[model samples]
Target chain A: MGKVKIKKKSTFIDMTAMSDVTVLLLTFFMLTSTFLQKEPTIVYTPSSVSEEKVPVSNLVTILISSADKGKVPEGKDATEAEGKIFISFSGGMDSTQVAPVIRGKMLDEALKVYNAQAKDSKKIALTDAQKKVFQETNMLGTSFEYLPELLSKSLTEIDKEQGDMYNPNTGIPIDGNKDKNGHLNDFQIWCRAIYTVSKELHDNMATDMGLTVDEAKTLGDLYNAITKDGTGIAIKADKDTPFTTVETVFDNLQTMSLNKFSLMTALTSEEEAAPAKH
Target chain B: MAEVQEHDSGKKKKGAQKKMTIRVDFTPMVDMNMLLITFFMLCTTMIKSQTLQLTLPTNEKVQKEQQNQAKKSEALTLILDTEYTDNNLPKTDEATGKTVHNVYWFAGLPDTTFQTNLLAKESFMGDTKENGVKVQQGIRKILREQNKDVMTNYDELKAQWKNREISKETFDSLAKKNAADSTLTRPVVIIKPGPNTTYEALINALDEMQINQIARYSIQLPTHTDTLLLENYQQRTGETVIRPTVRKSVVY
Candidate 1:
């Protein structure tokens, strides 16, 4: 028999097509995926049955906190024995304390903006002739020190306890006398702070930018112009804070301007188990 | 002759000799594949799994219904104040002298001066009467008044329905119309029981509202902002915030 040989065929596949498709899918997802920014930690929220949906356009955030133990009623007794703290104003105490705090925080933010502007203008010293113009303007001389002191005093007053003298002749704490007035005092301080901050910022901007305070006021006016159609103030209180405090903040904000405002609440995945009562 | 033949043979041999080779360019193919992948990737929508955010009402709807009568007369405002007491002892119905027979009914009734006065009388009776006849009578009276219009409308529609003269759409509309009109007259009951108010108490109120056929109801609670402020106050002062234990109605 004659000798014979058989040839074998080799099989191969190109993976480049599959790799290209996978890469395309990966790129698409990467581009389209939304990454949410980490939101602030929220400790509490006041409850309401209002179904009114607040718009996101106009918002001024207010932070609120309660007074210390000495400020609340029955604090000394409750603390010593049962480790309990009782607010003097019942459901409304927290609100009273927060009104002033918002005012203070707003002032602080305004002052920070003013200081930043002042420092930037100072970097390029004015010419001898320009210095006279600047001196006449006195824009650089504005001070924010007054704001901090005022805020501190307001905070102190809010933290003060109701006095025996303020108690009614019947020896029971009067509902409308010192305690009620005290609550309003915080609100007044907030209003005053807004006035002060807005005034200061407007004046300084006018002097620095060589515009009138009225022109400087345009900054707030512009902000209002943009956010005016919707609710004005946006308050975000810690979750653990009392509902009274947040209410007070809202009340103060409402009084500041007729413009509508909203309260922001942080939503969480885990349900808040009701607080354990004594 | 031999030279010419040899030369011709050499030329023929030279002409027969040749070299063959095959080649393919891969650059354009790679580029095209990449471009196709990019286009597909750009057009495709990525699947996203998201957690639905929800705000659950903390106030008990039935309880709110039992507390204030003014809510029915005007725009109802429900304020829920929940307190957790260690004892878990059910709250005494300060209005009724007798112990609550049905938790649902107790929770659903409006917390009004009338209800309170009735309860006070029942409590005074001190088991002198069998069952809560007076309380049942008071509830029935209010329910009848609230539902009078709707009940009448329902009867008219039902009669029309029996006649087989009305279209399906008209019948449905009539039924819905009757339901909505009746619902409006009925006050939204708000229960602002302290946390110590037992689950049994809350459930009883719910049952009562359901039995009374009160459909439009909402459980109220402090706003999110209020809760946050409370937390902040506690942290800053290291003090416990004491909320009011009283349940009162304000006419706004």
Candidate 2:
């Protein structure tokens, strides 16, 4: 505790290294970032304890959102006549109600894709140009009747002017109406289209793996060895959408014998709530 | 004359060098970088979404189940119904402040005995936190108690997995094995959402089923007996009740 020397040394420490590091990190994040895809609707998936990840490929994602009629009813035993989904209704069950709307753009790239060996364009009912657009665009919610128009329009133009063509309360119109031979609604037609296109891909893989196409349960099986657990159907619905809507969707699947599907939900990181327990 | 010129230039250069300094204050740059990092951190959705795989029975299968399995004790039916006062009519619940939801829960068929003891009317009151608490307190607690044995076994397996004594695959297999064991009691749950039941309550009920580890469960349509039970329940309670109606989907 002797002499208190008040010599002020230079306080400047070189932050050049730190700056370099931050810039590097920023660059890395910028390069690696995968931007969120613009969805037609904001689907707030319900939280759950189940942590099974959705399969990556050979999947058809179904997005379901509610259309609010006005103010939600409040009270015990409140009636749910307030909200209505905007979709064209066909007579099937109590199917007039609980219709959903989504818009899908057929990607142009898929129309160009044909069986190199067989060149079987006749198998499907669409012009090559139409098929190309159908394959290229994202499958949006629209009535079955509007599919032809959807096929004709350029997806990029639709993307730019999205709101003008927004058909409310319409989805791949499925009233669970099966034909004499068990053909479901527009939803099944969409699935058939996918299956027809993917047949070649599945066939090639099946052949490669020394399995017949017949043996491979492609449509309904969740854990198809050839597909490696591709659910094919991925349903993304808002937390508060009526179960009637979802059940009808399930009905559509059941009609088509598509039994297995995946329900998408947001993952909750448990570590967020952890106290300082080692 | 040249030596004199050089000496004057050198003197000029030395004077210029003394007056000027090259320095960069990077505090602003650092601040900008920090701001950007914070923005990205806040906006970025880091975690990937999870999924729940479900296999649904065909409509025919459900119909058969209703016909054949109603007598079974484990055949529990959970009908999710919405509440709107008759005055409110088609919709709109101006009278009640909370979103009125109810679950008409019962196990086995609506025999006189089953109706007397099995059926209970419960409200879907949001979660424990919210006044609308539809979480793990009411029907969930009851189901949890019913499936406690399997849940306990599954929990034990999970603990073992956490302690690194067993792998996840092993744990899952063991859990499956335990769930399938006939020695342990099992409850077959049937979930039926009325035409008006909000999607949230259905999901909450499904979530409850998973949380309680009740393995055998299904989403089914309400039967005639179920509807009758609801009518009886409404009459007894004298509360405005929404009836559970089937969607009449044909999947056979």
Candidate 3:
């Protein structure tokens, strides 16, 4: 009889298959991913059955901060933190009107309008470095008087300052500054600045492309994006927030003649009232 | 599959040749790829948010002559409100896990004297199935009944689209035209969200407009007449419908 020869197997794992799968997954994510824009606060938008998709570019988002219910300091009321407005602009897909460039131009135009309408003490004068910071900011939420100092801070400092909901200077002042009241509020000033800049950009693009207004309308131009298609300005508010909080934003938009806009919502499906099968 | 092997014939020559096997280890590569995937997954927003388009009449006041008034028979007003908890948060329904939103509706004009009891109350009950047949419930049912003329045409168009008889684009354009068809009898909806109403309640009301295919709808703040009707309803039903505003306006 022969002694049983024990065989030793190599202790190795062939990771080729694992690597292949992971590479495929990585590719999928890289191709399909859109980086989330950084905002000062997060809000859960109400869901709706409307199927219209938000446009990918040339959009202005108005974010309304909800009340801080969970963590309130000792003396302050929770509702005092509600209705703070923030504004962020996203430019077109093309290189000419990318976010940074559009933001820089908007700053210049807004400053001009604000300084013109604002009282001497309320005027905002930003240096070139501060303007650069403003261009890089994803969402801006400070009153006109506070803007010069807010933009001068470092990125982390700015974020920390704006994240404090109870800060008196944290939000853009959006009181009832009606158009018929003779002077525009800071919110209206921003709206007016956006309107002027977008109109100018649209006209310039139309002339440069040698396209007529009708042709530009078909080409997804800025004018159509803002006014005709009603997809440019989007109001994003929390689901649980009261209607009066959101209505103030709507009233301001209406005052600025931005009668047509969109509301951001998550998608949900409900059965149709019809008896037919979907 | 990762190993490379070379074979040499056992022949004596000027110099003996040695066989060699080459292998590549992919363990580190897999680890790095996993790390990258985690980063992308955390940083990416895969689902785009949906949008509902809305158009409000200009804030500028319009003269009475320029305003196209709806016929009294075709007018339907909805006053929306949301119940609030003692903590000032919106009170949620325990059964459905949805916030409690109440809809107070009246047809034609508000009867201030409460002689007709025209102001009826309804909640947003989306849909249900009874005895194997689909049925609409609550406020949706009422609105759909009022807009049956448009809904009938809409159902036909929807069926045609589902059967592949018409393209989606064609179906959409036709459906839009049918909704705006002036000849069909349609209800003119005025959605007045109360001060205590949540934004979600207002959105639900707007979504109803889209789902029911009602073309003429406008959002307006509640007037004094609406308040009077609510008070009457409260007195008759013994329901505490009116409350102080939960949100305090922030003034700089």
Candidate number with greatest DockQ: 3
Compared with the true structure, what per-residue lDDT tens digits does model 1 show for residues A1-278?
Answer: 87676767634334455555666665666677544211212123332222234332222333332212233355232112110111110011233323333333443444444454445543222234432332221011112322232223332231231121122110111121122113323233333344454344345546867976456545532133213432334443332233333333333333444234344432221111111111
TM-scores, chain B, all models? 0.31, 0.69, 0.90
Candidate 2, residue B25: Cα displacement in angstroms equals: 5.3
Would you list the rank order by DockQ, best first?
3, 2, 1
Question: Compared with the true structure, what per-residue lDDT tens digits does model 2 show for residues A155-267?
Answer: 87544433222333344555756441353455655554444434544455467668766675543321251134435567777655566677777776666566677777765
Model 1 misplacement above 4 A: A1-58, A63-232, A237-241, A257-259, A265-278, B1-79, B85-252
Can you write out model 3's per-residue Cα lDDT over A191-249, one digit (the tens) per residue?
Answer: 88888898888888888999897776675645577688789999999888888889988
Error of 1 at A175 (Å): 16
Q: Which model scores highest in lDDT? A: 3
**B248: Cα error in model 1, Å:** 21
Model 2 lDDT at residue B200: 54
For B1-252, candidate 3 gives per-residue lDDT tens digits of 888888666475755776867778999999999999999999998878989999988889899999979889899999999998898888877765788889999888788878863688998776788998768888999999999999999999999999999999999999999999999999999999998988888889998999889999999999999999999989988989888876674442
**Can you tell me the CAPRI class of model 2?**
acceptable
Task: Give the Cα RMSD of candidate 1.
Answer: 19.4
Candidate number that wins on DockQ, 1 or 3: 3
DockQ of 2: 0.31
TM-score for each model = 0.31, 0.70, 0.93
Q: Any runs in candidate 3 off by more than 4 Å, and if so which? A: A1-7, A272-278, B4-25, B250-252
Kindly report which residue stretches of model 2 are placed more than 4 angstroms away from their true locations once superposed. A1-18, A68-136, A151-156, A160-170, A179-183, A208-230, A268-278, B1-20, B24-44, B59-71, B82-101, B112-115, B123-136, B243-252
**Candidate 1, position A252, lDDT:** 38
